[model samples]
Each structure stands twice: as C-alpha cells, then as structure tokens.
Target: MDQTTLNYIVVGLSFALYFGIAIWARAGSTGEFYAAGRGVHPVLNGMATGADWMSAASFISMAGLIAFTGYDNSTFLMGWTGGYVLLAMLLAPYLRKFGKYTVPEFIGDRFYSTAARVVAVICLIVISVTYVIGQMTGVGVTFARFLEVDVTTGLLIGSAVVFVYAVLGGMKGITYTQVAQYCVLITAYTIPAIFISIALTGNAIPPLGLFGDHTESGLPLLTKLDQVVTDLGFASYTGHHSNTFNMFLFTMSLMIGTAGLPHVIIRFFTVPKVADARWSAGWALVFIALLYLTAPAVGAMARLNIMDTIQTGEVGSPEGNLLYAERPQWIKNWEETGLLSFEDKNGDGRIQFYNDKNADFASKAEEFGWAGNELTVNRDILVLANPEIAQLPGWVIALVAAGGLAAALSTAAGLLLAISSAISHDLVKSVFNPEISEKGELMTARIAMTGAILLATYLGLNPPGFAAQTVALAFGLAAASIFPALMMGIFSKRINSKGAIAGMLVGLVLTVGYVFTYLGMFFIPGTNILPNTPDNWLFGISPASFGTVGAVFNFLAAYVVSMQTEEPPQEIQDLVESVRVPRGAGGATGH
Candidate 1:
C-alpha cells in the first residue's frame, strides 16, 4: 500500500479506538468527568499520567533534539523524567490526599482565601494553554505530513476530535484516551528504535546497543558518531559542545518545571488512596522510562545515520557531499511539507549538509567545489521520519503518524480539561453558584469546556512566542506560581493571605521577567536586560533552570511574610491537618 493510504487506515483505526474508549468509559457525573470519579486504580492512573505527561514534544521533538545536539541536550531527558521522581517523592501523594478536583480548589481552601485560588486559576490556565498550543502544533505537523492536509485544516480536525471526547466525557474521557495514546506512542517510538539497534549493534536493547560495539564499524556507536561528525567539521556528537553550566541549569529547570505542572498533579487526585498515588507515580515513571531510556540511543543512532548520509560519497558529486538527486525517499516526503528544504546554495546539483558555523571548514568546502550547507532538517521531524529512515514497512510509518497524533491530542485534551475545570469548577461553580444544583453545575462545566477549547484553538493557531516553548516557561509558570502556592497551602499552616499573595506575585514576576527578557520573545529586540548565559545569570543559574530558584524564593518569601503577619484560621488549620493525613475521602475535593 502507498504511504498515504496506509496513513489513512492507521489513523482511522486510532480514531475509532479513542472514540470507542470514550463511549465505553463515558463519564455521567461531574465527579466522573473531572476526576474519573476518584475510583481509578493506581496502575491505570499511572498509565494515564504517562500519556498526559508525554506530549508531542516528548514523543516527537526530544530525541531529535538530543540526536543533533548530542549529550549537551541530555538536560531535556533528565529534566522531564527527573522531575517525576521529585513529584512522586515530594508532592503527588500529599496532594492526592488533599483530594482536590482542580489545583486552584486546593489553594483556595488551604490558604483560607479565594484570591489564592484565583491566582492559581490564572497560573494553571497560562501553563495548560501554552502547553496545549505546543501539542496542537505537533498534531498539525503530524497531520500535514502524514494525513496530507493543510495545517490549518489539520488543527481544526484535531480540535474537533478532542472537543467531542473531552467535552463529553471530561477527565474520564481524557484518562482512558491517554492510556490508548501511551500504548500507541510508546510502540511507535520503540519499534523503529529496536529495529535500528538490531541492524547496527547486534543487540536488541537500544540503550545497551548505544554503548555496545557497532557491528559494521567495530566501534561503540557513540564513539563512531563522535568521530564521523567531527570529520565533517561538526562538533563531536558524544562530546560536550554546548556550555556545560547552561546545560546543567537547563536540565534542572526542566525537572523543576515538570514537578510544578498542574495537569500532571491533577492526575494523582484521581487515585484511590495515598499509597495508590505513591505507587501510581512509580508506575508512571516506569512507563516514562521506557521512552526516556531509549531516547539517547535514538539520538545517537539518528545522528550517526544523518552524518553517514551527508559525508563522503553517499549522494553528492564524486567530490561533493550528498547530491540533491540522492536525497532519501523520506527526505523527499518531508520536503513536500517544506520542513526539509534544500536550496543547493552553491549551484552545484549536490547538497552540502554541514555545520555552517564551522569557520575552519569554510576554505576546505570551497576547495571541494561544495557550495554551502543545503539540507535543513526540522527537529520535530526526527521521530516522525525515523521509521522511514530505517526502511520500516509502510504500516510502521503510518502507525508513527497515528502515534504522534495520539500523543499530541491526548495531552492537549488533558490540558484542556484542566483549563475548563479551573474556570468552571473553581470560578463559576465554587464562587458564583455555591448553592447551584449538581446537574446545573455540570452543565456549566461542559459550557466552560467548550468555550475554553475555542479560545485555545484560536490562540494555538497564532500562539505567542513566549507561550509556545515547552518545558521551560510552561513548567516555569507552574513552578513559580501554582506549585509554590500549593506547597504553602499544604506544608505551612502560618502562610496567611498577605504572605501567599506576595510570594506568588514575587515568584511569578521574577520567573516571567527572566524568561521574557532573556528569551527575547516578549518584545522585539529585547533589552538584553539580563544575559541568558550561565556566567551572567543570577547565582550562575541558566535562565532555563531559573524556575527552581524562583520557587525557592516563593517558599522563603511566604515563610518570612507569614511569620511577620497572621496565621491561617482555626478551621482552615484543621482542614490542613485533615488534608495532611490520608484518612477518609475517596472523592476528589471541590466547591
């Protein structure tokens, strides 16, 4: 079968599977819709959290990032997974014990202030919406490439599908959809990796193969990649190329960001008990590790493949780097979407793929009759194009597209659910309709969800630059704002309204200002007010890693201010003690 036909069949099967699951696990009440009725098994919740946590970025973009950038990009790998360890150890079980339907609800009751919850609601919306846009963009990219549709159309289709399940079934719908998504995305990720590892190393496991001898070359795969890339004037793939300090900070930032994210936290709220939350986190990490462990291998192998394609006699003229005519079928397919572009800058029919910034290679390339670097590969295409790169079957390629969409759409739906519930459950129902009927409030929640989706869809289509990047700001906002508030609410009984508000505002401002000014996204030609470089950063922290620092500031500020002011009220203090212990409450807390 042709790739496009296979794509349709695979995508069709996935759609049917998700829609069917939505039907089978359709939520009837607001409780079921928002928190899966707080009756979910820890194992099942872990799987759902895995899917919810690994969005398009993790499935599609991350390995490619590590593939091209080498070990310096390992921060992404460590940041994302390491944070889960922190979440499991520090936050998940305690919060699950707190039993909130939404994060803001916990903040509201814990701090004995509506303002605290409102601030949390804003931060949650910011984090989830930004996160959702990236997922939406990933879905569109996958659709445009595999499903053969314009991205605008793809986004619309993606949105419509998510709307149906998410709006209808709520958290119940998203949780089950995520389970299927995790399976599809993980299978798609690992199968090609296993094939590539077997082909190259005679070892079945990619991670082991990564360190094992390459069968053809008789060298460790990393060593081979490092040698070959450096021979072509590119930095050694296995060596440290990026600034070590910045990379360390960036990795730490990702970890803290991961722990701070609200949507991931809410997943724990659905578990049956405190112990279930603890075990659930362990299971989620286990599932996540399946990909996290394999990602480095994929990176190394893909880098090796790319270098081998570009160097010494693959495609270009007898003297030139790979010729334009010799482009792979996968490259041709990706080129159709304008993601992989080749301009033949030298007017030679051959395409030069190299590190243009390598000053030492300039004179050598000129002598070799090469023009300039011609091949441009988008990082997001790495995973999507991996099956094709490995000469996998048409079904495998098609399956990858479905898997990418599933990962993107499922996470997007989870974020949307969180956003909608924050607005409806926290704001509308909690504050406005303290006396409203359960059915009436559920109706309001559905309406809120629909409106939230529409808004997100529009924002996603033209997202702000600051808003779109994953791991850093999205997680930063959560950490600097929501995570801090939730922590204060739970651990610090003395955190009064004044302290909570000031701490959140301070954390939010410092983190946002640093990200915006240094990232140069908030304004055109930003002030260079603060250098993003590690040496120049506050306390030698990478701007990417600054959220953890900001979170610490929040903790300190709240603690100091609380000591200087009043304590949490007697009733709220009792509520804190009740939440601290894992006594009763099989249900998630709410208005």
Candidate 2:
C-alpha cells in the first residue's frame, strides 16, 4: 500500500485499540473515576505515569529543540528528568498517604483553610489549561501531517477520543489507556532512533551511538556533528551558547515545575500504598529515561543528516549545496504546512542552509555567489520528519504519526482529568455542595471534563508557542504556584493557611505577569509590552527560567508571612506529621 493508506490503517488501528481499552476499563464511581479505585499495581502505575508525564513536549518537540539549539537546550532533558527524583523522595508518597482525590484537596486539608484549597484549584486550572494547549497543538500537528487534515479538524477528533476515554473511564480508564499508550509511544520513539543510530554509528544503543565513532567519518559521532554544523556556519553541536545563569535558572524551573505538576502527582495516588508510590516513581523514571537517553542521539544525528543532505558538495564552490529541484520528499511535505520554506536568496536555483549570522561565513558566501541561507526548517519537524528523511519504511513513518498522537492525547487526557477533578471534586462537591451525592459528583466530573476539553481545544488552536515551549510555560507556573506550597505544607509545620495562600497568590500573579509581558498581553496578539528576547529578560533569566525565581519568591513570602501570623492548628500539625511516615498508608477512601 502507499504511505497515505498505510498511515490511515496504522493510525486507525491505534485509535481503535485506545477506544476499546477505554470501553473495557470504564470507571464506575467517583473513587474509580478520580483515583482508579486506589488498587493500581505499582509497576502498572509506573508505566501509566511514564505516559502521563511524557507529553508531546517530551516526545515530539524536545529532541527537535535540542537539534537546533545544540547543548544549550540540555536544560530541557535534565530539568524534566531530574524533577522525578524530587517527586519520588519528597512529594509522591506523602501526597499518596494523605489520601486525596485532587491536589487542592490536600492543600485545603493540610492548611485547614477552604480558601487555600480554592486558590490551589485556580492555580491548578491555570497550569493544566496552559499545559493542555501544547498537547492539543501536537495532536493537530500530527493529524495535519499524516491524516492530511486541517488543525481544527485534527483537534476536534483528538478531543473526541480523549473525551470518550477520559470522561467515561476517569483516572481508571486513563491509567490503563496510558499504559498501552506508553508502549506504543515508546516503541514508536525508539525504533526510529535505533535505525538511525545503526545507520550513523554502527551502534544499536542510542546513547552509546551518540558517543561512538561515526562509521563514515571514523570520528566520534558528536565530533562529526560538531564539525559538520560548524562547517555550515552554525554553532558547534556540543557547545553551550545560552547565558550560564539563565541556563541554570531555566533548568531549575523545569525541575521544580515537573515535581509540582498535579497530573504526575495524581498518578502516584492511584497506586495501592505509599511504598508503591515511591517504587512507581522509580519505574516511571526508568521508562522516561529510555526516551531521555535516546533523545540526544536522535537530535544530533538528525542535525547531521539534514546538514549532509543540504550541503551535498563543497561550500564556496559554484556547484555546492543541493539544488531546489533536488529537494527531498520530506521537505516538500513540510513545505505544504509552511513549516519548511526555501527563498533561493541568490536566485542560483540551489538551496543554501547555513547560519547567516556568522560574519566570517557571510563573507565566504559572497565569494561562493550565495546571497545567504535559503532554507528555513521549523524545529519541531526534526523528530517528526526523521523517519522520512532517512527513507525509513512507510510503516515506520506511519508509526511516528501514531506515536505523536498517542503522546499528545494521553497527556491531554491526564491534564483534563486534573482540571475536571479540581472543578467537580474540589470546587463543586467539596466546598460548594458538601451534601452532594456520589453519583451527582461523578456526573458533574464528567461534565466538567467535557467543558474543559472544549476550552483546551479552543486554546490549542491558537497556541503561543511550539508544543514544548508552551508546555514549559505551564511548568514555570506550576513551579511557582503549586510546588512550593506543597513542600511547605509537608516540610514546615509552622506554615499557616494564611502563609500558604499568600505564597500561591504572589507566585501565581507574578509568574503569570512575567510570562504574559513577554508572551503577549495575556497572550493576545501584538499586545506584549516587551519582545520575547533574551536581551529584555530580568537579570538574564528568560521567561522559561522565571519559574525558579517565582518559586524562590514563594518560599520567602510563605516564610515571612508565617513569621508574622499564628501557627497552624495543632491538629493540622499532627496531620502533617502523620503523612511524613509510611506506616499508616492505605487505599484512598474519600474525596
């Protein structure tokens, strides 16, 4: 069969499989809907967490970002992965032991203030909504590429799939669905990397292949990559060009944001015990590391491959570079989306893909009868087009389509669940209708979920950035508003409800403001006060790194406010002490 028919066949099968799993695992009660009945196995929950945690940002956009920016973007890999250590050691078991259905519930109960819970719900909603935009966008991109549909249609179809599984199955349905998704996504991710690795370095293991000698160049893979890219006037593939302090802050923001995200934390609550939560975090990391380890290799190899393709002959020669007529099929496909463009700057009919910013390179380009760089590639296309670029089998390309969708859909479902639970369980039932029936609450949860899907889909259609960049902003907000509050609630018994609420407000307000000032005026078009550039950053901290600063402000504000206020009630203090140990951990029984 041709690629399009094969793509439909493979992608159709995956969707059918997911819908079937959702139907088989439909949730029956609020408990099942919220936390999977608290009976999930540790290993299974771990796999589910891996799927939940690795969104489109991780699977689709990350390696591509690294491919274009080189080592400067390693912050993404380290920040996202390192936060799991914090989750495993500091947050997951304690939250699991607290036996709550939603993150705000823990905050409200721990602080003994309904106001604290309400603030948490707002923060959760904000973080989750922003995060889901990326997933929605990813789904749209995947559909537009493989299914040849428009982004709006792709988003609607994706939202329908998520609504079917997430609304019907709740956490129960999502957990098992995510487990199957993890398998599909990871397989899709690794198979392409393995093929590319062997093709580049004669090594099957991607990480080893990243460092291994290139079969053709007889130099280390990275060494060859650095040489090729720099030869094309780009920075060395291994060099770090971003500001040092900003990189550190950016990395810290991602770490804190990862540890603080409500969706990942809720996965631990589904497991049977506190011990299970801990082990599940480890297992989740093991699964996550599989992709993390291979990503650098994929990025590096893809960059090298792309460069080699464009620069087929010696630079500065009349015959240098691939002619426009000789452009590959992958380029043609992406060009239709406006993601890849060619300008033919010199009207030479040949494409010059190079760094025009390098003065030395510009002078040489003049000598070579070249005007400037002519090809523009979107960073996201690196991973998406990798299989096609390498001329891998039609099935492999189709699998990438499925994998990208699976990653986006799984995480979108998880975020929507978090948002719906916050509204229905935490806001509607817990505070507004304390006497609401379990059945009424479950129905409300499903409704809230449907509403959230509509809102997120709308936002996804007009996302502020690429899949990963949009998600990173959400992380910054999470790090600022949620993570610090949870840490103080557990580690500092002296922090009062007043202090916690104050911290979240300050963090949320300031972080959102900072992000908006650069992103746009509340993300409106052409409304930003300042351009989103490094020169306009605060103390050299980019908006992506501003989360760390917000977190620090949260810590200080909470501490300072607590010093001037009354302490938490003695009973609340004891509740804090109880969760610190794993002895009394049991299945979560109540909302």
Candidate 3:
C-alpha cells in the first residue's frame, strides 16, 4: 500500500482504539468523572500519568529544540524530568492524601476560603489553556501533513475527536485511553530511534549510540555532529551558548511547573490510596525515562542526517549543496505541508542550509556564491519527518504519525479535564451554585471541556511560538502562580486564605505582565510592548525564565500578607499536619 493509505489506516486504528476505550470506561458519577472513582492500580496509573505527562512538548518539539540548539536546550530534558521528580517526591502523595477531587478544592479547603479556591481555578484555567494550545499546535501540524488538510481544518478535526472521547470519558475514560496511547507512542518513538541509531552508529541502543562512534566518520557521534554544524557556521552541537543564570531560572521554572500542573497533579488523585500515588509516580518516571533517554540521540542523529543530505561534499565546495530539483522525497512531502521550504535566494538552483546571520559566515558564503540560507525548516517537524528522512518503511512512517497524534491527544484530554473540573466543580458548583446536582455538574464538566477545547483550538491557530516554546511559557505561568500556593498550602500552616490569594495574584500578574510585554498581550501578535530579545529582558532574564523570579515574589508576598493577618485556624493547621502523615500506608500493601 502507498504511504498515504498506510498513514490513514494506522491513524484510523489508533483513533478507533481511543474511542473504544472511552466508550467502555465512560464515567458514571462525579467521582468517576473527576478522579476515576479512585480505583486505578498504581502501575496502571503510572502508565497513564506517563502518557499524560509526555505531551507534544515532550514527544514532538523537545528533540527538535535539542537538534537545532544542541546542549543549550538541555534545560528541557533536565527541567521536565526533574520537575516530575519534584512532583512525585514533594507534591503527589501529600495532595492525594488531602483527598480532594481537584487542586483548587485542596487549596480552598486548606486556606479555608472560597476566594482561594476561585483564584486557584483561574490559575488552573490559564495554565491548562496555555498548555493545551501547544498540544493543539502539534495536532494541527500532524494532521495537516498526514491527512493532507490545511492546518485550520486539521485542528477542527482533531478537536472534534478529542471532544468525543474527552467529553464522554472524563477522567475515567481519559486515564484508560492514555494507557493505550502510552503503548502506541512509546513504540512509535523508540522504533525509529533504534532504526536510526543502528543505521548511523551501528548500535542498537539509541542513548548509548549517541556517545558511540559514528560508523560513517569513525568519530564519536557528538564529535561528528559538532564538526558538521560548525562547518556550516552554526554553534557546536554540544556547546553551551545561553546565559547561565537564565538557564538556571528556566530549568527551575519547569521543575516547579511540573509539580504545579493541575492535570499531572490530578493524575495522582486517581489511585485508591495515598501510597499508591507515590508508587504511580515511580512507575511514571520509569515510563518517561524510556522516551527522555532516547530524545537526545534522536535529535543528534536527525541533525547529522540533515547536514549530510544538504552538504553531500565538502562544506564550501561548489558541488556541496543539494540541488533543489533533486531534493529528497521527505523534503517534498514536508514542503507540501508548508512547514518546510526552500527559496533560491542567490538564483542558485542548489539549496543552502547555513546560518546567514553570522557575519563571518556571510564572507565565506559569498565566496561560494550563496546569497543566504535557502532552507527554512520548522523545528517541530524534525521528529515527525525523521523516519521519512532516513528512508524508513511506509509502516514506520505511519506509526510515527499515530504516535504524534497520541502524544498530543492524550495530554490535551488530561488538560481539558483539569479545565473542565475547575469550572464545573470548583467555580460553578463550589462558588456560584452550591446546590448543583451531581448530574448537573457532570454535564457542566463536559460543557466546560468543549469550551476549553474550542478556545485552545482558536489560539493554536496563531501560536506565539513553537510548540515547545509555547509549552515553556505555560510552565513558567504555573511555576509562578500555582506552585507557590500548593507548596505553601501543604508545608506552612501560618499562610492564611488572604495570603494564598495575595501570592497567586502577585505571581500571576507579574509573570503575565512580563510575558505580555514581550510575547504580546494574551500572545496576540503586534501587541507586544517591547521586542522579545535579550537586550530588552529584565536583568538578563527571558520571559520563559521569569517564572522563578515570580515565584520568589509570590513567596515574599504571601509571607508578608500572612504576617500582617491572623494565622490559619487550629483545625486547618491540624489538617495540614495530618496530610503530611501517611495514613493509608499499611493498607496500600493489601491492595
């Protein structure tokens, strides 16, 4: 069968499986819809969490960032992985023990104020909606290429599929469906890595292959990559080029953001016991490691392949560049999607893929009669196109298409559920309509999810940045606003409702104001107050790294507000103390 037909069949089968799971595990009650009735096995919950945690940022854009920027982007790997550790170690078990359906519920009860809960709901909505935009972008990119549709139509189709399953299954449906998605995505991710690893380094393990010698050049894989990129006037593949302080802040933001993310924290609420939450976190780390370890190798190998294809001979030679007419099939397929393009800037028929912004490189390029960089490849397309660029089988390419969609859809479902629960359970039911029936809340949850998906889809069409960069902004927002509130709610009994609310407002306003000044208000283009450059950043801190600074302000504001007000009531303090203790530890073994 043709590759296009294979893609349709594979993606169709995956969608059918998701729909089947959603139908079978459809939620029946508010408890089931919000927390899967708290019956998920630790191992199973772990697998589901893995799927939920590894969104389009992890699967699609992460390696692409690593491929283009090399070691400077390692913050993505460290921050995300380390952030899960922070979640598992610091937040999951305690939050699960608090026995709340949602993060806002925990915050409201702990702070003893509806206002705290409402603020949390707002934070959840903002963080989740921002996060969902990245997933929708990934979905649109995948569908546009594989389904041969425009990005807008592809996003609508993907949105409809998500609405059917996510709105139907809620947490129960999403949890089980995510397990199946984990299987599909991991298989899709690793198979290509293994294939490319063996092809390039003659090694079967991709992570090890990254450090192993390249079979073609007899040099270490990273060493050869450094050589190839430097020859094209790009930074060395393994060099660190970003500001150290900014990298520290960015990584810390991701770590705290991971712990604060409502969708991920709510996954812990699905397991039956508090101990099960910790166990699930452990299992999730194992599953997540499978992909995280493979990502660097995939990035390096894909970069090497692109360089080799473009510079078939010596870098500066007249015959080095690939002819536009004879470009590879993978390039042609991607070009059709409009994500990858080549322009003959110097009227040369050959494609030049070099850094034209480097003044030193411009002199060398002029010697070769090259006008400017001719190829424009979107960073998000590297992984999806990797198998094709390597000439993998039709089935492998189709599988990757399925995997990308699975990664995007799984996390989108989780985020939408978080948003849905916050609106129906936290806002409408808790604050506005306390007498809301269970059935009414469930319907509201579904409706909220539909609205959230629509908003996400609309914003995704005009994303402010690449998928991973967009995700990073979401992380920064969560880090600044939610992380401080959750951490203080659990660890400090002196923090009152007023303090919690004050902290969230301070963090949210500061981070959002900083980001809007550069990225545009609500990320609408042409609305930015300043150019988003290092020179324009405050104290050399980029918008993506400003979350840590915001968190510090949150901490200080909460502390100051609490000192001026009364401490939390005695019972609320005791409740905080009780959650810290492991009440159901012994019972977890019996299960």
Number of the top TM-score candidate:
3
Model 2 regions lying over 4 Å from their true place: 583-591
**Model 1, 1-591: lDDT tens per residue?**
778998999998999888988888888998998899988888888999999988888888788788888877887888888889988988887787776788888888787778887887888887787687778778777988999888788888888889888988889888988898899999988988998899889999999999999898898878888877776678887777666666666666677778878889889988777888888999999999998899899888887777676575633346546667877888888898877888877686776787777899877767676677778888778888888887888888888899899888878888888888898899888887788787887888888888877876776665433222454567766777777777667776778887888788788878878877676654234555765565676666655667777788888888888899877789888877777764555543321
Per-model TM against the reference: 0.93, 0.98, 0.99
| Lowest-sum lDDT 10-residue window in model 3 | 582-591
Name the Cα RMSD for model 1: 3.0
Instruction: Write one digit per residue (lDDT tens) for candidate 2, span 1-591.
Output: 989899999988999999999999999999999999999999999999999988999999999999988899998999999999999999998898888888999999999999999999999999999999989988988888888888899999999999999999999999999999999999999999999999999999999999999999899988988888888889888997879999999899999999999988999889877778888999999999999998999999999899989988887777878988988998899888777899977888999998999998888778888788899887776788999998999999999999999999999999999999999999999899999999999999999999999999999888887889989999999999999999999988999999999999999999999988888864766888898888898888888889999999999999999999998889988888888754444443222
What is each predicted model's overall lDDT from 0 to 1? 0.80, 0.91, 0.93
Separate clash counts for every candidate: 4, 0, 0
lDDT of 3: 0.93
Candidate 1 wrong stretches, greater than 4 Å: 312-320, 463-469, 520-543, 581-591
In terms of lDDT, the best-performing candidate is 3
Candidate 1 local Cα displacement, residue 76, angstroms: 1.3
